[model samples]
Target: MASADSLSKLLRCPETRQELRPLDDSKLDELNEAIRAGELHNHAGDEVEQTLDAGLIREDDAVVYPIRDGVPNLLIDDRIPLKDSD
Candidate 1:
């Protein structure tokens, strides 16, 4: 996997065109907790079935795109909204 710094330089939100940064560990943990508990769903309304290895959070911190096995899932329907969470 590319280091966060490298990924940050290359990735952007497909919808917003905003720069993205790695999701911090604390937030990743919280996200996984929600995923494990079946409490989170993607914008597509499908339950997210796998825990993320990493995530890219948008510059404004409004959403995150999941990275699994070193590949980013940037599909619009797969972006998880951060503003709606606790």
Candidate 2:
């Protein structure tokens, strides 16, 4: 299980290019499962209602993050295009 602090270091905004804080521990776990399961682009828990980082909450011994505004955008869009080594 990855720590929220490590996950926080892993996360970054797509458009803003800013570091993202773990929504919560529970949300972090949910995010881990979701990412491994291909649920969303990346693990970005409910940011609509809950704080960017909230208290830990457990469910079924699993973390469940609230879906905010029906979307989770955690991917960083690299502006620099890949250069072909032709």
CA lDDT of every candidate: 0.88, 0.37
Write candidate 2's Cα lDDT for 1-86 as tens digits. 99756865764444444554434466556555544565433123322323222322222222222334544433332111112210
What's the true lDDT of residue 65 in model 2? 27
Per TM-score, the best of the predicted structures is: 1
Angstrom error of the Cα, residue 55, model 2: value is 14
Which candidate number would show the highest lDDT if scored against the true structure? 1
Which consecutive 10 residues in model 2 have the weakest lDDT in total? 77-86
Candidate 2 — which residues are off by over 4 angstroms?
Answer: 1-20, 42-75, 78-86
lDDT (10s digit) by residue, model 1, range 2-81: 97678578888888798988899999999999999998888788898899999989999888899999889999899888
The estimated TM-scores of all candidates read 0.87, 0.27
lDDT for model 1, on a 0 to 1 scale? 0.88
Query: Candidate 1: where is the Cα deviation over 4 Å?
Result: 1-4
